[model samples]
Target chain A: EPEVTQTPSHQVTQMGQEVILRCVPISNHLYFYWYRQILGQKVEFLVSFYNNEISEKSEIFDDQFSVERPDGSNFTLKIRSTKLEDSAMYFCASSLRAGEGDTQYFGPGTRLTVL
Target chain B: GQQVMQIPQYQHVQEGEDFTTYCNSSTTLSNIQWYKQRPGGHPVFLIQLVKSGEVKKQKRLTFQFGEAKKNSSLHITATQTTDVGTYFCAAHAGKSTFGDGTTLTVKP
Candidate 1:
């Protein structure tokens, strides 16, 4: 089964530095999403992307966050400046469609640790 | 903002015991999905429920969606040690929102 894959399984960066988390969603999937899990917290949605644009985003996805489909298979999330609170396990997910019942497959996740 | 709440943050069961987790959404959902995550592993899709009062079963596991589409439950019969993991119920309104999840620890 084809699955979503993310690069840099673990990322460590300075508090004020910029960081990019990369994901390669399933080749045929159309909609992509980013979610984060703070240590023991519930998974939180960050943003959704389709057609090279953001469909929706949460308050946590503020000015510091941006997502892009720089290439056909690459979906990248960039944080302009990392904060301590931003440290979490970031997961990239994709589904063949954006319908309510569509099943979204998640990647292994990239653990971001900001110092 | 929509919220999905799951009861019993943790569950411990001996091998061959049964287990169940309940999930309630603050608002009506168009659909609900269940995922399981093992220790240090990613969330894996288990099942999806679309219609109200829908029920689906997989092997020894069963899932149900409430008539109001605001609640759901996952039940496992005679669960084994392999059933050890965290189960999360995610609701879809416009976007998917996940519950806090119930962590199951099965002792063999």
Candidate 2:
């Protein structure tokens, strides 16, 4: 089965450095999303994208975060400057349909570590 | 107070024993999805329940949607070591929100 894949499975960056997390969703999928999980915490939604634009975002997705579908298959999340609290497992997910019942497939996740 | 809450955050069952997790949401849901994430792994979709009081079974696992469409449960019969993981119940509307998850540990 086709699955969402993310690059740089593990990323380490300085506290004030910018970082980009990349994802290649299933070729035919239309909607994409970014979620993060602090160690020992529930996964929190960051943002959702469709038609190369953001559909919704949570408070955690503040000024520092931005998402783009720079190419047909590549969806990237950029954080302008990392903080200690930014260290978490960032996951990329996608679904064929942009509806409530559609199943969203998640990537293995990129573990971001801020130093 | 819209949220999905799961009970008994952790469960430990001996091999061949049964296990079940409950999920309740404050608001009605268009659908409910169950996912399993093994330790140090990503969430894998298990199944989705859309209709009120709907029940679906996958192998030894069974999922049920509540009559009010605000609750759900996942039951595993004769658990195996492979069943050890954190099971999350994600409620769906225009946006999807997941419960804190129930961690299951199966002992051999």
Candidate 3:
């Protein structure tokens, strides 16, 4: 089955540096999302994108965070300045549709570690 | 903000014993989804329940959505070592909100 894939399985950056996490969602899926999980915390939603724009975002997705579909298959999340708290497992997910019952497939996740 | 709470954060079961995890959402959900993530792995979709009081089973695992759409449960019958993982219940109203997940450890 086709699955979402992310690049740089692990990322280590210095605090205050900019970093970009890339994801290639399923080719046909329309809705894309980004989530993060602190070491032992629940998965938290960061933002959702559709129709080439952000549909929704959480408080965690502040000015430092931005997402773009730079290309047909590439979905990238950029953090202007990395903070220690930004160190977490960042996951990308996509679904054919957006609804209550739709299943969202998750990628392997990129572990971000800020020094 | 919505919250999905899962109970018994950790469970240890014998190889042949059964295991269960409960999830409750602060607000009513339109649907609920279950996912399993093995240690050091990504989350894998297991099942989705949409209708009220709906029940679905996949081989050894059974899932249920509460009639009120605010709670759900996942039950595994005769769990094996392969069942060792963290099970998360995600509630969907407009966006997805995942629970803290219940980690299962099965001893052989």
lDDT of 2 by residue, A1-115 (tens): 8989999999999999999999999999999999998887777778888998998788889999999999888999999999999999999999998747899999999999999
Q: Indicate the fraction of true inter-chain contacts that candidate 2 also forms.
A: 0.64
DockQ for every prediction shown = 0.75, 0.73, 0.77
Once superposed on the true structure, which residue ranges of model 3 sit more than 4 Å away at CA? none
Q: The CA-based lDDT of model 3 is what?
A: 0.93
| Candidate 3 CAPRI grade | medium
lDDT of each: 0.93, 0.92, 0.93
lDDT of 3 by residue, B1-92 (tens): 89899998999999999999999988888889999999988889999998999999999999999999899999999999999999999975
Candidate 1 vs 3: which has more DockQ: 3
Task: Return the top candidate by DockQ.
Answer: 3
TM-score of 3: 0.98
> Model 3 chain A: which ten-residue window has the lowest total lDDT?
A95-104
Query: Can you write out model 1's per-residue Cα lDDT over A1-115, one digit (the tens) per residue?
Result: 8989998999999999999999999999999999999998888989888889988888889999999999898999999999999999999999899836899999999999999
